[model samples]
Target: MLSICARHCVLWSIGRCANGCRTRTSHSSPRFPKSRSPTALPPMLKPSVRSAHSREYLGTWGISNGAQPGLFTGTCEGPRCDASGPEKGYTPHARVQQGFLRLLVRAQSALVQRSHHKRRNCAISGARFKRAREVVMASYIKRTIRLNPSQARTLSGFANRRGLSEYALLLKVIDAGFLALLHGTDRETDLAEMASVIGSISERLAERGTSREEASAAEKQIAALDTREAKSHADHKSLRADWRATAEAKGFGEAAQARAIAEAKERARAGELAASPEILAARAVAWAAAKLSERQAVFPASTLAREAGDYAFGRLSHNAISAAIAEAGERGALVPRAYLDRRGAESAGFTTPEAIATEQAMLRLEAAGRGVSVPLASSLAAARTVERAARQSARAGFAWTDDQKRATSALLTSRDRVAAVQGYAGTAKTTTVLATYAREAAKSGLTVTALAPTASAATVLGEALGLRGDTVARHLVSPEAKGLGKGAVWIVDEASMLSARDMAALMASADKAGARLVLVGDVRQLGSVGAGAAFAQLQQAGMATAKLANVVRQTNADTREAVMASIEGHAGKALAALERGGGDVIEGASRDARLATMAQRYVALSPTERVRTLVIEPSRDGRDTLTAMIRQQLVQRGELSSAAVRFEALEAKGLTRAETRQAASYAIGDVVRFARDYADKGVTRGSAYRVERIDPDKAAVALKAADGSSVDWRLRQWGAGKVEVFEC
Candidate 1:
């Protein structure tokens, strides 16, 4: 038989030997709702005694060690507990003095012993007292057939060196176990888990303490989560109710649902709806927050939105607010736009506004630093759909179309001469074209023809169609567009920079296929890489004479001022005019700065002059800088014997694609951050190439990793950023 633990702290159980734990049938009544028949019950326990917590000698006495409410009862035993009351031969009660005197005498005896043998434990103590003290300790420690003398010698050696007795080890275990219980876990398990977490925390301490900028805020947030306050919850709820009541009284009917409608009406009433200076500041803050989040410094929108887009006093338009994103992107402004979305959502996705701005910065960095050609691309969507093609097709739900009722179905369905749509930046033009394409394409069951100015631009078009192109197209005349059958509608995107020749060629191609045409693009985006040969078709057509001047992108004076400078050929005066007044070069768009941004410049320049002077672009790389970096990384990793990888970083404002391709370079295992995406493909952690096989504009780098692997990646389509050849 083995003795196991009982109700007492002392081990006091008798159990069957060899293994552990025992099972016993309980005799308690069944605990379900009662049935009428007692015969339904199976069996009854033989009459026998049972312990409250155990079967025979194995009782659950240790449960009181924890004693959760309703689980078990506490017993007055173990340490700190004394005999309950005097009984038998002892008196039932004692006078207070008697108790005190007894305690006093015990203390007096301990004091005498301490005084007499205090030095006995010390080395070389006086002979008489040393011997006496040893005798006293030994008498209490008396044992028979215990540890042998030789074993005792080893114990004595340990006690002498550490100055700790065997009892001390027992004390340490109890202390650790008690602490584990307090932390809401089983003693043994909690102790192990806490040790593991603490070890990891110690390792990461250096990283967490790397910055102190938001130290207080982080601490406050942690504290807030750790403790709750009921008062604030009540206050915010009360405030919501009041705001609702006030809005209803004012006929606003709770948070204006249609901002566009409301804005139009307000501006109509005043003849102009310019936002106040404070509103202007708030809008800037919102814009910045969005930009930051795109770059992955994601923040909360409640921190910024109410302050953005000053409509009444500052002349901020909804479109203008959106355009600022492009301006920020171009300027390398890092704002977390994710934090400034409608309804103040803090979702994971970076809307077009935030993403465009961050990518602008990243694109600039890749061009200037690594000599990589990065395009500032976004899933940019425009609000109003284009009506040219859609309106012609009655089934697509266009509001109106030209009255050609007397003409045949040909006039209502397709046109002989192609139509062109052009605009820059904003004006809700591109969006219009895309919407028209989607609707008309859906209606006709005919493949729509599309064109782009460059391979990258073509890819952009393909993205709009949920497809990735097989080959990069330099002009709309590429073979990819020939698939359109007769009676189809052709959509030429980014049509502004497109030559009238390519448009003419595409029109011929479309005509051959019996397809109607609607050409769309941003004229401000540019038609050529400053190439004389490239613009000949456009120059011959003289379509540059057609212009849409009601500037839809910027309704705010300051935003318009900024965009004026941002568009390729119109920025110099915008910047100079802005600088002449309150525009804070330091804070960018503080109140004074915004005011200054609205000023007029002494002289205005042509589009060419403005782009040349105001735009601070470095010459595009003659060779691929980023490709070189990748090749170098490959060489370092022993993956390549390269044509070479070059590392270049630029701060250019208008870096060119031609120059980027000219300087293009790469290596294996090179990490890149896509200027267009900060995450999703923001961090390109892999690239490696085997040197002998690749073209100048492209690299045949080995695909070194799988998706989300975090290391060694290869890409089919890529852009470059500040190249780090050796380290990336």
Candidate 2:
């Protein structure tokens, strides 16, 4: 029976046995016919039960069941079969059959040895293999990791050296790395324990003989580590929560959330969202509308867009802002104005509805002022006397230019209550023309009153015109303002700096008091800080204007030319003229270096030259930086005193009428500096005083000056454009 089973096994292995046995062929081999079954196969030749390992090992060789069909029944009729096994003429070769049996025995023995070796290895390695198998079986997760070319090459090289397929090598590497990480954590714990033991020993030693500082330092180190560990744990928990929230928002499952979080972090690091055009546009438009609503009611579209870009912190391009503006306008969030057509709105400007109403009110005030006549001179005799005085003044070497003379004559003789003099800068409009007007108006029995937008300007105008200077804001709230009538002439310097609201108020007061209002300033200079180009608008409306075209303040011809060019908005030509006139444009590698260079140059100048020098910077930040550098240089050279009194100086801000009228805005003990003279109350311009008390019910404040003198000042006296506060 053993011989018979062995022969059948050999025959089955060769695929030559024929007892309804199907021939097993390789995938690429040809199919063969099956022989008819004569009877059932011998019982010894039937399929047998085998171990799982043996089945798995033999499965690769296409031998799952033991002793394939037709192995024993052998009514052998295969093309290669002799058909003479025992009862047939032919029989299998003894040598070939014996060799095949030996080969099979060796293969089985090798597989058994491999299995035994794996078991022994697992036992020696603390069941590492078993754990790995369990891990593989428990987790069926599939992941694809992309590698760069360099990493791919490195992986390939390592896999080849280790005689492993790439997939097997990756799995092995992952397992090793995981084990190493766990081992590292265990080592850290052990080291921490060792450190604790060492710290205890050090403390004990210090109590006996060692220095206390060493022990304390070790204790501090341990405490610091504990703190760090606690902080790290907190951070990890927070990060996990945040990641979960993000994953939930993105509808990501647990397995995919980690990859999504990593990708999001990568995008944030790259600034993919913050720098996007859509984000920039949205931020800019929102910030711009907010700024416009808070401060100015109208702005040049381009200027507002630029400011909005800065507000967005992105400094977006003009095109981006333009697109945003177009969208905003369509939605009625912004009103485009000053444009002849829709197309011109891009370049003309933008305004709020409130600003448009304010403008209309201003125009109405102007029209009313034009109708009310306040004749400065009662007769031709009075006018002749004024002209003679002007002529005498010009002959005395303080000669008025033709433009100045014309402006003065116009102011003196104009019958309208409101008159405008469009003077350019450095034209001596205040010193020569307005001074002449004040003298002539006074001689003609008209009381001349000088007002300016700021304290320093009001003071200068008052000095030039030989009158008490006051701010427009202060004059509006003064007691003497009610007494203004037919015989009064009011001269407002820096008229261009008055917002539409302020201008309208001034006009209304003059019209009501039957006083002549004379506006003197260059419309080309800085516009109003708060809102509305009132002066420019009035001039555009063809108000009676006497223009001072020539500039006399600048004696140098090149400087005068540059001034004229600048006034005409030819900035390039003005700069060229300045350069030709020995003006130095200092530049350096960076802003700091340039400021340092300017400061050094400033320090090298004589006291008088430094006083005369005007450092004009476009931005407040640049001015501050340059000023700080100059101050440092001055201190180093001992040109300025090192001793300094520190105080909080609040720069004046332009406020609206509503803000000025709010009594709740005022506080007790606040220090304020008046920008206009209040002679009757002994309050001088540019004098700082502390608020002794506030009477919100009475709308008044008690102010105490440095000299201990106090006055009950009206709350309206603290109007915008009239006072500044300082904290000391």
Candidate 3:
């Protein structure tokens, strides 16, 4: 039985087992066959027990490793050779079959282990694996959004026409959205509003020609929105207050109380403080604090109200003043109780001890040369020396009238470091006061530089003094100007027109050079154009000023009296004086009729007389109309060419089709006026240009200056709000 089993085992290993296996060569690997009809032997060859050789074959396959255990073994003599396992005795063939099944299980597990080891050894590192995962995720990261059907269709069409992909079009939209948000505004709403404004402006430009009306309308719209929103916020605050009162009545937290107070402040900011006594008082204190300064620090109730404007002053009743005083009295530092009286008048102003000390310290530093500025000098004796020198120079150089001598003597004898020659128009300030000062300073071995805020003023002064004068920005305050000697004198004309900051800078510059500054202007004409009312402030601060009430420029007595009355702010007297000068008020039924009559009168004059005549109008629009009429009349008289184009002033927003058309109409050899100064090119505000070339596509308008130099500028540039290019 063992011999037969061993042969059968050999046959099975080589794929030729007689039981059911098909035979193959020894060199060939063995495999179990599915069909056994052609290879199966009859049941006679089937062993019941005693298949020793098969057990040996099983051992070779590692089935013998479990022989000593309770597992299956290929021996019929063992009690474990039963069908259940080696626990019960089994047939030899059955035992061999169990060993073969175990061998197949072991082979499968080994194959799984080998494959797992290969996977572990060839696995990716953490970083490399993460990078690979990111690459895969990046391919799917793009978001897909649905657009409205019509919008999608239109966008697709536009993209196709522009040779751009749908994705590229989306990117373009995103870029525009980013720019709108860059200014820290609401992107969607702001962009939409701006687009609407632009569309309206463009349509208006196309239809009626460009004007400032559209820009004004846009500003009004924005203002209206702000007002509406403020009202809404105020309403919300009132509603919140009602809820907050109830919350506090119940046992609410500190946060709720804090929120209530914050909402109240917001309501005040929205101008909803009419019913709130606390907010009104707080507002008064804040307003007074802002207006307080060392120059004019005290505040009487009436004066404070006047500074607050007519609208606010009208709102301030006795009750309002009482409420403000009551609240301000609670805070001694900001609004001191000592400052407020029973009548609600604040004698001093809302200021702290620290602030007062700081101001005093600054004044001390200024006297010490650390913060020396434009005002009266620290030394009275030094100022007297400078004044004496000016007087001596004037006396030795030229003969003068009694009034001129008096004015010259007054300026020279002034004790204030910053002296003003307060003279009205036609007072011979340029010829008498300024000229004498310049000549006197020069004779005293002092460098006298005449300066004015504007080029025209400087030129007038320069021509009158026979010494070239420059704008204050160019000569005194300019960084490029050489340092002045100790005895240098700056004769500043039109000194009243300077803003506070410019005045301060001028003073600081003068102080640095240890120079004497003589400010010359008519204070009664107009105050500073910008801010702080420097001339007025200094005059009020007790600076020495020479008053020149006598008029010398106007030869006619009636004209002189009219000028004097106007300068003194006597309206009725000024009108009477004008009537005395044979100046009558003219009235016409319409502006057009008045313009027509004026044109006829101008045309009736001889060419020489007409050239000397000047027409002045109160309004810019009126001036433009009169200019057009005068130009048309000049053309009729052959004084001007018909080819001259009337270029309208550009509005603040942007250029319109009408302006572009006017600019493009200029041709070669046409002369045009530069409406603004281009200082870098030495072209003044009213410089003339002769057009040499024109390119409409590039918006280029090439011009040759009077000096024969040529430069090209864009038509749009020439039509900026600050500039206008009119055919000359």
Candidate 4:
């Protein structure tokens, strides 16, 4: 810092005092009057400092290192004397801009100093340092040091903007002198987290008592809001984002904009311009580092650090010259390397870029020496259920909603007592209710047969109840229960989705097995498969009626809407309302960058593949053809494999929805191939399913039979099967 400050002030006449630094008054030098008050010039002002009336007025001026520090009236030549603008103040726009930067610099300084004070234990009574225990009980510095996913994101943005390594930013912050802002934030966040969890549970229960579906949804919603605000700040506002984007619109040709800004900053600090090759070498080294990482930007334009030092600087634009060079066993840019060489040759005390670069290198090397690893989540719900041995009950009476507990106590108080659970809304009501009943029933040493109308419905419920996670297998009689001493209870999950044959077979098995039958599902959500619709018909016949009201939806609006809209037939409209913009749209976005990004997401793609995209105005007709063209193109361009395509509908796969939604606007004759995403990663081979139905948000499809069952596909994967109708 001292060196940087010194360099900034060096070219000015009133230089900062240093150890034994000397200066002689040059007769021809121009003089500018100093002022005791900022706006008031010296009483004895002069056009030039004459030998007879010259006296240093060092203390008379307010020396802000920022440009335009008051006029220095000296008869100097070259830059100092070159004709400049009449007034030293900034132009109209600049005044505001400069003022803001000055304020920011001071703010950052204050933050830095505050941290410094905390570390040094500066005066206990000092206001900023007071009540240290409470101020830092949950130290931000310690937590930030842990490198959580969120903080890493923030650090990455900062470093990327400055054209520095993220590793460098981490080191800079951890520098003991910079960690003073660690007060109260962590504890406050923790309190919020707890409150959020409790409130979500309470709200869920109030809305839907004993409704198992609602409880599961409420948990996911509470978590999304918890991170949204934090994520916004971490993402950077779109305003300043344009300046940081790596593309043609940045309005530059040769090097990176960040690199240019860095060079300008270096020049501002080094008043007389770089006087040594070491400075130029630093730029070269910086350049080399960028070229090595496809992720890093190349600084465009000739740099001052290079221009002022060596011939190597100009050579950088040449094809073969690497931006940096290795010198003395350390990675160094030409400027720094030259500076280091000159230092050895001349014994100057100036710091070389290579020295600083080495320190940064060592830090990276040390971090890389350590290794760590983690796992993947592909249907974590099912995995978790399996891990718990299929138990859904909490240690304390299953953490049920009061209404559910009431129902459980009233109708199910006795261990072997039979109760037919029911509900619809906020979730897959029928399925959740039966699953909960099945869970409680499991502990009675009695088997519970939860029948689902369709294989898909069975698969959905299987996620929680610990079954084969398949429908066909779920309804078939298990040999283990052939002659059970204790009778089993029957549960029909998504009973509305069962076919006549499956439903009849299920009923036969339940009756023969002496199982008490509990049929559940939302007839409004969708009618049952084939004759399985018989269960909902039972309600019309009046066995026992239980209607569920009140909604318990997930924190994620999309998931909640998906469950709700399918029942109402508007899932697509709800989903399409979500705003989406940030993505790879601008040209010159390195294809590789886009591809690497996809690897993190739908990992099966490579950078060089020709990506297919379509632009269209909002319209209602001709979407199918467009979707098909896209799919055709994918196959034509070899983006998606052909063997993975299938043509099956929700019926073939056993999924049910409200009459209006059953089609999901299904063309009634649509077909498609399916693909499976592993841990949301690789697109598994032979995983293609057929698109059986279509709607605003997605197409419902039956995945190709692997062992034997239909698959549910995500809307995002929909490619070429779209209608192409457009408006002029």
Candidate 5:
């Protein structure tokens, strides 16, 4: 085989053989090993470059390094070599667009010649062959698109404006359109927002000069108000000082005198004295003034009206004041006017309008602890059926925690047909739902499905319930999904994350399917990414709800207590617990600096491929800053290459429509990470894949797996319609 193959390869080689025996060598060009025997040859394995994956495979065979296949010989020759083969079918100098095959042929011819004639008599390495071939026939497909008159005009205008060619302009337009579709934003809302922005800009321009003058006038008014306020406060202080002097002169400023007044109030309450306001005040004053002033400080009848205006605690009736003075004169306890003023201040603090309103609201919350119920249309008999199911769930053979059992019970026994089960983090809400699903499956063989506003959350729900999970949008669009038969039930997780619009759509779908829905989430966690709070509104509108309070996931009592406290809004407690656990709270001069510091700390952890840590950031800006810093650190550590430092410009949530359209779009060969898990397909969330092909017309995409295989991944799988592109 070696002899035959060597003869055949050598015959196919290019370059003239001085001996005219069909044997070839690179001796006419660079250095070539002298022929020991004209029977040695390179390996006959064919290189496959039909697809992107095939090119990668060829680069790794036999020769691990991606070197060209001229290693069998001591030299290599370019197309300029005096190499000749059977009739020279393809002239190496052809002006036609050279493709992979043309390049392959050129490389193979030179490699075969050197292999057959080389002194080593060794086979050519595959890695070297691929590189040599790439250097030869580098190819491209030239496609000419015919545009209509209007499109041509538009393209030319845009190109001229951008200082780019019409072709580049077209590419830009395509890229922008592709991103808009990938982001999945509401067109109407975007337009409305755009209009609002335009209006605001116009208004600001019109008001610029007027605003400066108005600001000046406002400053003058503020200064006047400050002056008046200062005078009024000084008068108040002087009045208080005078009242205190009178009280001290009468011995009423003593703590003992105040204590006596308190005792007298108690006695009056116990019926030891008259409980009338005048009598009570009189007794308090007389008891307080008794020691120093055998006579009480007196005000003239004519001056009483003027003096009463300075009285504290808003205004007191003249008759009441006169009666109090008379009693104080008789009791001989020096009651100071300053004491009355202090009492007024304390009363004002306690009975502010806002404080009273808050007290009323708290009362309402207490009353609504069991959750207000909406009347259901079901009859007693129908209700009893649900009640029985509820009982059975509690008795089911699932390993349910107390909280889980209660949560399931709440779902089954909700007074209103619509209800929510509010579970705190790590409270086994998912576990409870899965148990119910199993129970329903066993009794009536119902299709217990799970849906979420996001693909990732839905996937998690589906996994726990042993069913396929899908986004709520998918169920809403399919007519078949409407009115899930009576036996079917749908569980919606992360219910709090659904915007009002999404909630309405999901509800409409549920109504169509006639399937029962059980919403479960922790409201204290993140709300919807879009607009409006449907979950909170529903809870406020007297919707039936079961709030799961136990912190089931945290094993440490202190940590669990801290988590529960934080959820309940006890910031101090949460911080204390964290500090006890050796967690340090780092404060930076700015949020950006803090984020950078955090990135530095993460790098210091010395993470390996599988031992990575997660840095949870609350804001998008913080996340972006930390991400950039982390990328830079990785590059510095030699974990990433300079060429691989591509920023993943995605049209993710929280970006405006204009920004979304202007963001960078995905192209073939860009690496992406799956943001959601598709477990059945063995593609988990965070898994990496490369974009193989993109069809902007169809909004479709193809992905190449890590193992050099292709998967028909559609746009729907890309961040559940809002394609989350990332650099791996």
Candidate 6:
């Protein structure tokens, strides 16, 4: 079978030799037919049968079988086949044929195995290549897009504005556009649904009529109800009073009559007889009138309204109070007036006729003092000479500017009994200008007396002017004021702090003594705490005023500019200047944190800088917080002593007169400062004493002085504005 198969293979090879040779045979194999050449061969045998060795073997078989030999001999010549064949003289035996057949079978089997391995390897390689291609494609895809000139310019402009490259900007635009596309459908759907809902709601509202008309009708109904309620409440009160009177007149016992009245009142309350707007308004008006009478001065309408609301247990509104006030004014029950408040803004309030009369008297006194003029002790020429001489003889290294010289000359030449010198802060008002004026006045043989609203201010003024100092309160009641006759110049520093009443008294005293009154201070620094802007008012009233305009204290130009701007009421500009000048503007996540940072920075400053620093806190609570924080920092840095002393100190309670009259308000260990002298009780004005004992039964309080002396003070004498109480 092997030989026959080999013979068939040889026959097939010989039939289709590359040399155009053929073999004829009567018998044919099924794979190679008798009348056709072997054009197609099996896949396994194609390589082996096409090789030179196979061709040589076939040639040997063909020759041995008496067929052509050269047909297969030179057929396998090319790069695809080795030219070498079986060695010369080699016999084509049966064993050799069998070995060649086995070799061919083994080669076919190996080829089959290699083909399978290649197919498997190709599948794996194709999968990996596909994955790598997918990743590369996903990472980035370069695409060419066509754009019009306008679109290109717009894109370039957008990229420039965004500080991005054109490529990057385009990518961002594509990403944003994709996101917008994804969300656009949802947004449109939402809008359509909203429109549908709105349409439905509009139809519903239309069916119910217009909303504005309904609201107006509801308001009218409410107003009518309020009016009816007020009338019902008044009628119920009258009916209850009439029933009580009838019951008492019908010989009912006291208890029975009281019970009847109580039951009637209860029934009225249980019904719709609640107090209405009119009643509340009337109560608010009455309360405000009482407050005006008690304070004996005009207070802010808004403040009074808030107080009235509290008094009425939140029954009164501000509008109700205002309306009541207007009605009372119309009926001559109250007087409505407007005055310039501390901030130089007009404020409206209700005042009593008596209070108005008092204010008129104060104005008249101011006018009278202005009318009285004081002749200078010397001629104008002599005063000018004296001023020039004083300026020339100023302390070493101290030179007066033109503004200071002018201010001094004005003060010296002024003949008005009440004169004013308006100077801003840091203008050397007291140290240079006023000092020069005082020296010139002294040289002119006029006695200059220094006075201020506060003792510390007076001390500063006296030290600057080289004279004795005294507080305005003390000076007013002292014998020195009585002797202030002609040739005396009374210099009042910090005169802006003087209330209208105090100014009137001081002017009257100066006028009567024929003394020239000099009012020196900055109106913008701090205004009068009591009732009036007398300093600014006097200037506005056409009184002779000498204004010191040049600021000399601040040497830094930026700081000076800021101060000038603030003085001129340019707060925003002043703040900007301060920032530009490197001012410490501490800011933090919270107010406490900012304050803590400020305290830390303050502690970091040198001792000299700390002494020069001025911290202005608008509220007492804030001031206390800042002070505590600063002290804590100082202690931590060993700049301040860690030890502390606790004692009773007077802090103004700012209570009302009625609140202060209750003896229960007086607590032991609390300190009180007398605003007026109580000589009989050994308590002097402006003196603070601790309350050693409080006796509510006797309506008296025993106060111990700082010197260990005790005095009994009547509780009634501790009214508001007379004595300030401080909790220990």
Give lDDT tens digits, candidate 6, residues 108-201. Answer: 2333334444442221110111122112111111121122111111111133433533323333433333222211222434333322322333
How far in Å is the alpha carbon of 298 misplaced in model 1?
49
**How well is each residue in 232-322 modelled by candidate 3, as lDDT tens digits?**
1123333446534544555454676657765765674455435464555456545444444222323344544443332244556656655
Task: Residues 1-728, candidate 4: write the lDDT tens digits.
Answer: 11112222222231211111222211111122222111111111112112221222121122222223322222222132123411111111111222222322333333334445445332112112112222221111212212122231121112332353222233343321221111112233433332243334345555545332333222223332333233222222442343234233334423566568657655753642343454555454443332221111112123323322233435334322222243412532322222212123432112234334433342332223222111111244324433342245344233334344333332233222222345665533433344544665675555755456566666666665675444534446576335543456655666656544454455455445555555556676665333224445445544343555435555465555555655566745545533222133333376445433433333234444334433342432334444455565557667678876565322232222211122332343343332323444223443443344354423233333344454554333332222211112
- In model 5, where is the ten-residue run with the lowest total lDDT? 148-157
How do the residues 1-728 of candidate 2 rate in per-residue lDDT, one tens digit apiece?
Answer: 12213222332333332122222321111111123211111111111122232111011112222323222211223444322222111222222222233334333333334445444332111112222311321111112112211111111113342343333333344333322221122243433332243344345555546432332222322332332211111233334565456445555557676577657656753573357786678666765665555456566776768767765555577788888888878877778865333243345667766667777887887776665675555567445755676678668866657777667677766777789899888887777667767877887788889999999999999988778899999998886566866788889999999988788888878877877888988877877876777998988876888998888888888888899998887888998888888887655998778878887888899999988997777776898899888887889888779887776656443443443443444566667787788788898998888877876544567889999999877654444346666433
Q: What's the true lDDT of residue 433 in model 3?
A: 66
The TM-score that candidate 3 achieves is: 0.40
Model 6 alpha-carbon drift over 4 Å, by segment: 1-298, 311-333, 339-348, 351-355, 369-374, 377-383, 386-395, 638-641, 656-659, 662-670, 673-721
Candidates in order have lDDT scores of 0.34, 0.58, 0.49, 0.36, 0.47, 0.58
Model 6, residue pairs in steric clash = none
TM-score of each: 0.25, 0.47, 0.40, 0.26, 0.36, 0.53
Ranking by lDDT: 2, 6, 3, 5, 4, 1
Alpha-carbon shift of residue 51 in model 3 (angstroms)? 66
Q: Top model by TM-score, which number?
A: 6
Model 4's TM-score against the true structure: 0.26
Error of 1 at 262 (Å): 81
283 Cα displacement, candidate 5 (Å) = 68
CA RMSD, predictions in order? 32.8, 30.2, 30.4, 31.9, 41.2, 43.0
